[model samples]
Target: MRRVVFLVQPQVYLLDLAGPAEVFHTARDFGLPYELSYVADEPEIITAELLPVRCATTWPALGANDIIIVPGKQCATLEDVNPSERALSMLRAHHRQGGMVVSVCAATEALGRAGLLDGRRCATHHQLQDELAARYPAAEVVRDVLYTVDGNLATSAGIASGIDLTLHLIATWHGPTTAGRIARALVVYARRNGSDEQVSALLRHRSHLSDLVHRLQDVIDERYTEPLRLAELSRKFGCSERTITRRFRDATGLTPLRYQQALRLERAEHLIASGTTVEAAARAVGFSDSRTLRALRAAGRTAAAVAS
Candidate 1:
């Protein structure tokens, strides 16, 4: 099995470590060929959360298919982090041997110290964008992006962007379908492109978990182009229309019809982004009337404006 090894650094932020770890763990739970492990330079490491982290001290033999992730730590400045040179060297050596290297948030500093980010496009937390560029003149720092992929190196933005970056990696290694499934299971809105900052309405509307809600989401996700009425959904899973409606709303804060419409609208947006006309985009996502599509577009704009 290909290993997904996390390199734990001292004074690390817990979420930066846990987010990507849970992502890979979910992939493994889905029966993917991934062995998740953690390595540390010392027997125990201190976290900014005040919780101590301890993992394997001995480094495992890595292969080309293996991935090594360096999660960002909590600090006001990069100087506050104290990762050992040996750990940074391990990342450089792994990359040199054709292995993939990933960095989360401030973890890009570790990559910078190892000379891995030099002359490569990378991303980090927005707060540290200028500092990253100044510290590593050769590294091209991409701002306002969840993550960036430059050759074997990948870097993600702060905090929650780690999940989006890991999902992208999953789609890269597995496929878009698998990544979508994982994201749905995790109830996360997957970003098709890091440059797009908006999350899909379907994902944002998810409030809780329910088996019926998940089943309905899977069907709508897999076949959003087809006609999927509420009655059809009710019949497919042997649940009455009333039960499905109430339960779905209780779990996801939206009706089944609205959820399906959200999927169609999200696809329409993507189609337009890829050079399709507004009418063509609407038709491409199962809308027969451009009038309703126009209204949906207007409503979307209104919602975004309200949020902004």
Candidate 2:
């Protein structure tokens, strides 16, 4: 699970390559096992960014825990791909060996051409949704989505969605606590669970900056499990309650109390996902009772339903 092999191609989009790669790389910062390697059909490939990416020309053998990522290029059509038979064979072989195959943007073409998408549900950027279906009639080209997982194959939409999909994979493998730590460092606060609503609290209201708010956030990050009061926070930071509430809302779009609740809820979720009971997770995360957590989860469901 430590090794991640990226298959680079000429004219590949730099964001498409870096978005996912950086996710795994950032996970390493949180002490996750991640070793990255780059490979290509040639010694080097120029990106759409006008940058050169050099990689190993020879494909290495991969194991079940390893993953292969094929990022999309600047292709308007499938013919835009310079199909390397050896690269395709390596992809097919790795997949057959039970390794994960991840494709971003138009790189779904790689999976389709390798016969990996046949009758398998996959996804890509919104623009190429129709083209993927038209070209690979047997493949289910899901659209208007962040990512789709069909068994061992994971496909994602364009650009930023690559990071979202990679985070999902990391969460699945290592639990949400590890993923949440990485997302927080990346300044990504929220993620959609491929639900009907493609937004979440972690993603809302986050495009402003305030030192006061940041200081408060750092304190909350360290003491989310403790009972935190607005008056105490305001006094501790030498700010009035009005200024604290206003600035916090302006920066993060959540009240201080709600922000703390979100943090607790996220940790509670990770514990629950790791097989802790709802009751146990609630207690572990400093929830007074499981009923409160259930109410929060139910409210979240209602919010998503309304948003959708």
Candidate 3:
């Protein structure tokens, strides 16, 4: 059986712990064998957001070839949480030894504190956007997105976003069709994509950084409605065009043009899902016309169909 360990902590959000657990437990229906367990730094009764639950064993006692999930806690102060020390250590060690480590919401901060997020791209609750960015300057913090998977580390935003992240894992492990079936059985309309904003309107908070790169991101964020050109941005920054291109590519994987298009498409998708007319979405995202929009939509549909 594939093993899944939930490293439960004090004040852990019940849904964050349960949502992914339900997905892994239901793996049998998708023809995957899974053994799920709840673990902590010590084997004892612990109180979560809900009624007190007993942790069956210490993390060290768990076996291998499985997954470990760190659920979000209500508290933001991770440095003072002693319950996280052993659990975090185990999670890092497990991940280093090739185990999948999942962190939801504020729990992503624990992974950062444990040094697991160094040089990794991740997402977390937008409320902690500044905290995570300032705390781990080396880590790339993506706000608004539902989840991000950097190699073995998987992270999600706050609260119900855990459901989306968990269902994504199911799709990765089994297949999209199986995951869709499970979502239907569970009565969820669809699994939120990784790019979906889990913390809508909460990403206004940003880290205090002198990096001109942030200004670049801001320009893209605001001027997504306007035409974006790498040469124009380079001229604006007053540096060599090569320096601008290098810094922008280093900070974000895409060229400035591609990144702006991605943002526009993301907004377009949000409109489509929210009952907005396709034409409205096209105009809102600054597409030249509906011909390009329809083509993009068709391409996206084909990609999703292929993935499924």
lDDT by residue (67-186, candidate 2, tens digit) is 999998998777797658888988899899888999998899999889899989999888888888999999988878889988899999878788888988887787555665677778
Model 2: residues with Cα > 4 Å off, grouped in runs: 174-205, 222-253, 266-289, 306-308
Clashes of each: 0, 2, 0
Pairing residues by index, what is the TM-score of model 1?
0.72
Clashing pairs in 2: 189-202, 190-202
RMSD of each: 5.2, 3.6, 17.6
Model with the higher TM-score, candidate 1 or 3: 1
lDDT of each: 0.83, 0.83, 0.73
- Candidate 3 to truth, TM: 0.62
lDDT of 3: 0.73
Superposed model 1: Cα runs more than 4 Å off: 189-193, 200-214, 222-308
Writing each residue's lDDT as its tens digit, candidate 3 over 1-308 gives 77788888877788888888887766666677877889875565445646676786655344446788888877746553344466667877888888888898888877886788889999888888788888899999988898998878999987878888887777666544456556655656546788853321102212224377667767776677788777788888888778877776776555667666666676676677658888888998898777777887788789978977
Query: Residues 1-308, candidate 1, lDDT per residue (tens digit)?
Result: 98999999887889899988988889999999999888998889888888998889988999988999999998898776567878888888999998999999999988888889888999999999999999999989998898998889999997888888898788667755577778777867645467776655545654465777877877877777788887888889998999999988898877888887887786677667657898998887788967777898899999989998
**What TM-score would every model get versus the actual structure?**
0.72, 0.80, 0.62
Over 4 Å off in model 3, which ranges?
A: 42-50, 60-64, 80-82, 197-308
Give the lowest summed-lDDT range of ten residues in model 2.
195-204
